[model samples]
Target: MAAMSKPYYVTTPIYYVNDKPHIGHAYTSLATDVLARWKRLEGQEVFFLTGTDEHGQKVEKAAQDAGMDPQSFTDRVSQSFRVLAERMGFSNDDFIRTTEPRHKAACQELWRRLADRGEIYLGAYEGWYAVRDEAFYGPDELIERDGVKYAPSGAPVAWVKEPSYFFRLSKWQDWLLRYYEDNRRFIAPESRRNEVISFIKGGLSDLSISRTSFRWGIPVPGDEAHVMYVWLDALTNYITAAGYPDESHPRWKFWPADVHFVGKDIIRFHTIYWPAFLEAAGLAPPKRVFAHGWWTNEGQKISKSLGNVIDPLALIDEYGLDPVRYFLLREVPFGNDGDFSRAALAGRTNGELADALGNLANRTLSLIQRNCEGKLPAPIENPHLMHDTTLHSGISDLREKVGKALEDQQFHSALEHIMFEVRYANSYITQMAPWALKKTDPVLMLQVLRLLHDALRVFGTVLWPFMPTTMDALLDQLGVPKDQRKLADLATPLPGGIPLPPPSPLFRKIELAA
Candidate 1:
């Protein structure tokens, strides 16, 4: 495929600041980070943004319970998220906070733009509001059990009646449906697309965009009586981080993001409400909103009450950041829900990392050092016809397949393809018996070693996006220059006869205590 000339913009849903960072937060951020890293390596201009959503009734009440002002509470917790991002090695270009002055300006500007366009109107809202979800529920969307109404997710709801501002979301139903039909990739995962299309087809109601009962959010521009709803405020952060309201801003060129990665539960807000708001403001909707499934703890929903919320910091401390990042993306299909288990993590690390990749690097580098006097051997021209042809074909095929997988956002499949190459190289080494050939025919041994170097170079380049640290180690052992690491470099071999570094294990086995 030809290289993409346009910039790529991607975002993670701004996390709520009411709680500490958890595995779900880590999962989404890591996925976005991997994409950002891969795109940058593929030579695209990329922008990755992630931040905390600090405005809502939930934050207000949580602050009250904690005996501190809302800002103070949010500041303390929001830092934890920032720390988590750094701990996980997230390559985010911007970290936007709703309370930031720039974000406030963006939100106010969005409100004025929508209101001036007549998409905002005064209205009274009476419905079941779930504090846990920070969302309002229609009667039909709520479930009643034991005389109490709850959200479909089992979060308790409260009856709320207040004069509020509403966005004319209903008016865009047909436009949204037509947009979805025209842009089939707008909502990702075939299953997610059907769900979103069905929801929009059912009909969209005017969305309540302001709350009067709380003052912890961005005040509606020119109207202090109400604050913007948390969802509206949060959704605007994407544009805010890219410098909206000031089109001349340097990052503004990437506005109308290429993709917005979000959790499945909030698909309606991202796929429906967000697009309507953008259309009302005379801006283009994001190119795609891919809502991925949630991760449960040991096959059960992650909950604080259940004492099963996986702390991401704890996981990082237990396993290094890259390993954690690799496991999360490689273990589950991006949009499919899965369970997080320590045993499963250990298994991948032991089997794939230690046995396959790490051992291959150790074996190959050790052979080069032991047999070639610690000097890289130059590759013979065209080695053996059959062996050279097979190696070239396999590497070329794997590169194309991996590139396609990344383009489709199939991260797991991409990693799996690269590992398959690793497996093949290991098998080829054993079958060819390069070590024995060293004593019999030194020239043929050099040819065999050259083939190994060619394959390792390609594998290292392709694996960089997933296991960056390990890939760098492999490249260093092969004496590859940092500047030589690029997607295109996968097709070429590093010059031989350059001294290589002594090999070391890439991954150490993690033993879980009984």
Candidate 2:
């Protein structure tokens, strides 16, 4: 197992602490949560991390606007993000806070190393700075809106000049391009990769790494008057969690992350600037950075004035956790923007979860309960259908396809493979007519039920990461022990005539007010 041989580390972009967590935050978390869970199910070691980005001018202003100090504000808002993660049923290994002492030490150490390596130098900077993005953009990158300048991303910007420490990012433009060229898969989805390459090719500028204008961030080592750029400070959290400066730390094994799950807006930071910073610090960049697109609520874009933003908690309340998780990944291509509508969401919940998978499990198990005397039948007494038929071959091929799809970060493709088998199982049951076979051919009926039960086993094993709780219930119906719920374990046939509990509904059709 790659996970056991070489640990898998994954991180969601540490969320900003300015507002309550939204569907956007949940989207990234859900994606990485599923990936991390899948890695663990592969019987490998995994470190799944998530946390809040506490310090920045945005946070500082938000705190002041609320009449509180930055620390209190971050602490308060950070708890909300943690609550969001917990409420969403996230199984994160660690939740890091930038305000924590260990993180502070990590940030300070990274700053000193970059400074010592000649990658950093004192400089004066003048540019259109977007506090919201914590980014400084050249005038050409800003859009004029009603006499004010906004970053291309729509965040308002201000002309600012200050003495700061700058990272020699311009010096590494060619090297960064070569890294992307040599490592073709460094940035995901092809579109994001092209965007980063174009931006770097257009030109790289030395990035201001220290901010004297903002006092709410980690201070530059040896110069308390200057604070580290929020993005720089935030990016260091990855290494801080990995125990930087102490290469022997057990967590450092996860240093070069398997993936960094981020939103499309931050692709440049992750793809261009982040890798360069790590190489300068004498560390390897994360293996892959997957930048996924945003979500629109219903048909309208989410906005504050429209009040159309999705609260993931409310979405989960209306639709169960697993359904929401499944819909997000299945509804859109992994890297494309998707629309979130209650109708679309509920349709998948009822159509896929209830009618397709849940119904298949219920009918197969109920048939076993009635005909097999509440016990799971042994592996098909007649093994032809179990090992040699088209159904068997089709399912056998799926494991490889789905694994490859996931390896490519194609979440929708992976789930599509599972659903294909699901529909096949439904058609197989219809064709077999197990209900009719029960009286005419009792022996054959028991064997058919056994085959269907085995099919459920396959679904349960592969679908566990996406729908853990529901899969647990379905696996229990097949008498699958808790410890043996992995892909490798599905091949072991169920012991003959083992007791299986009564079938319970795994997914209920959502009832909405008409």
Highest TM-score: which candidate?
2
* Tens-digit lDDT string for candidate 2 (100-192): 999999888888888889999998999889988999998778789688888999999888999989999999999999999899989998999
Specify the highest-lDDT model's number: 2
Model 2 C-alpha lDDT versus the unseen true structure: 0.88
Which pairs clash in model 2? none
lDDT digits (tens) for residues 233-313 of candidate 1: 999999999889999999988988988999998888899989989999998899998888999888888888899889988
- Whole-model lDDT values for every prediction: 0.86, 0.88
Worst 10 residues of 2 by lDDT: 381-390
Residue 300's C-alpha lDDT in candidate 2? 90
Q: Which parts of model 1 have CA positions greater than 4 angstroms off?
A: 1-4
RMSD of each: 1.7, 1.4
Question: Could you estimate the TM-score for every candidate?
Answer: 0.97, 0.98
